[model samples]
Target: MNRWMRPLVWAALLGTSVAGAQGIELLPGTPRPLDIRAASPCTFVTVMNRGTTPATLEGEWVNGVNSVPVAFDAPAVPMCEAAGTALTPIQPQRARTVRVKVNSAALGTLLGRRSVLEGHLVLRAAQGGPAILTPLAVEKPSLLGRTGVQRLLWPFVLACLFILGVALRVRRALGQEMFAAEWAPEKSWGSNLALITGLITTVGGVTKIAESVTPLVTLTGVVFTLLGLAAPLLYRATLHSLAAHPDRQAGPVWGYLLASLLTLWGAFGGLITLGALLDSLANRLSGTSDDLLGTLVMVLTFLIVLAVIVFSWQRLVQNIDEQLVAAPKRHRQSALL
Candidate 1:
């Protein structure tokens, strides 16, 4: 739900595309970069020349930023060398295998480190029509590389950011309403609807990503499913139950916020598989075994949070009811005077 989980989900989703990687051949009619991602030291790109006349291919590793030189030998590896493409051009209607070897030692430095190096491999014809800008992201063997994520991943992230921002704003508005003791149906009603929606969904998918944490965390999902449904049930029982308690504290705002975040993290694509776990306190400083003596800690965490929500709302309602009951007595006293 916090730092580790975000990238963990990001990488988990990206990693799925890696298994789909298969042999590819480039055609001459349209120019597209042979994007590659691999944990291995060597990456190969197949280039096919379907054009007339001989064409020569040249490559350069334009280290956009000079720091991490993972693409060090990108230029040296001559692809389509079956026909001596190094010295001679490939005749028309032929193919070549472009092997790009990464400095594993340099890339190895990124393992256990939470970082990635990005660089471009520029592939072009010596006659120079258009260059294929092959973007290469070299990192830990288990994380994302060669992910053709430009089409879908970025847009999804932007949408998630927008949703997260809105959730936080709603939580803030609810808090402000309770603090000011000026809850208005016109003003706060929309936020309460948002809260009800979040609470229900968050519980349904709370432990969906439990396997990534511990296989045992899944029981919480079942429990939260019922727990999360309660908000909706309350509405069904009394359409105005929530409306009556306008001056109510937002229970476990942070917990609810994180639950909302985790729901998205688990529901969206899990692109990466963590080949190695980063050593941090989240793993109890042991970052070791994947065995399952597991339990539902995330559930317990949410249980406590939801309990606070119910408890605070009940207390607020009782206080408000007492004031309403006493209001008539005070009015009668003023009339008698």
Candidate 2:
């Protein structure tokens, strides 16, 4: 080989050695699944210059999509250098360890819907040349899964059950005759509220079950239709009862008020559930106008339910206070006579 060719040969051999030795190797000492639970500190290791001439190795983290290189200060080490790559020195036959502290955001981006951390380790020779890359994976602690409306079912059911139990207890304690005669208006209103709430619960439960069972949105449409039908009937019934017998007993007014509040809350929840079902159905079916209309209906239903609940609660409280004040005055007058 010519004198110039000899140097080129050496450079090529050095490059090959650096490339082979400098790539990332998972450290045997590290945990098999990198534990990255919560927003805590983490580290990853790569061996440098395993079988190559001494060279300096530079390190960086890069985004997989945009290929934007993020630089970190190269650790002190003797590693072979390659042309045109970030330069760091690594000693021959020695492993250079790289430590990386991943932030929560970066970990989340790399995880990609998995409750685990994942990314690539890009290792370059100290002499500034192409990087040898390897994939890195870390496990995120499995806490409770993602929370949404779907996860709220148990709590909602428990709330409904608790309210119903209280209402039943109040009714039994008050006695059937006194409940019917003294608090007739409130009783009527409460009964109507219970029926509406129960219907909504059943409809919402069915819709939830359907969503869990199948991904098809058409099923959701059927559920929404049922709720929509139920809503109008409930509204009419409640309105008629409230109009026909506006009076409420002072003693049982608190119980009615509590039931009314629960009913309103349940109605709002049902409206939200129905709206979601409608959106799912509309997305599956054609026609943008229909989807828009469905969404509008959902919003209106939520607002209306909220307003009714607020108004009814205020009325119940007022009646309860009035009766309490009047009862004291009447008793005093009777005692004097």
Highest TM-score: give the candidate number. Answer: 2
Model 1, poorest ten-residue lDDT window? 328-337
Per-residue lDDT tens digits of candidate 2, residues 1-337?
A: 4543532343353343222443333334432333444333334355656545665545433333422233333434422121123325556666655444444454443422223334444556556555554445455421111223332343245335544544454443322211111223234443344345445445545565333223322333333334333433333333212233355322233343343434444444444444444443444453332345545555665576556555554543334333332232222110000
- Tens digits of lDDT, candidate 1, 1-337: 5633443343343332211122122433322222222334545666756567777665554444432332212234444222222335656777765555555555444433223345554555667554554455543432322233421243236335744554544543323221112223343322343344334333423433222232212232232233333333332222222254564322223333333333332222111111111111123333422222111222333354344334433433332222232131121110000
CA-lDDT, candidates in order: 0.35, 0.40
**Runs with alpha carbons beyond 4 Å of true place in candidate 2:** 1-253, 287-291, 322-337
Best by lDDT: 2
Relative to the true structure, candidate 1 reaches a TM of 0.26
Give candidate 1's error at residue 80 in angstroms: 15
TM-score each candidate: 0.26, 0.32
Backbone clash pairs in model 2 (N, Cα, C under 3 Å; residues 3+ apart or in different chains), count: 28
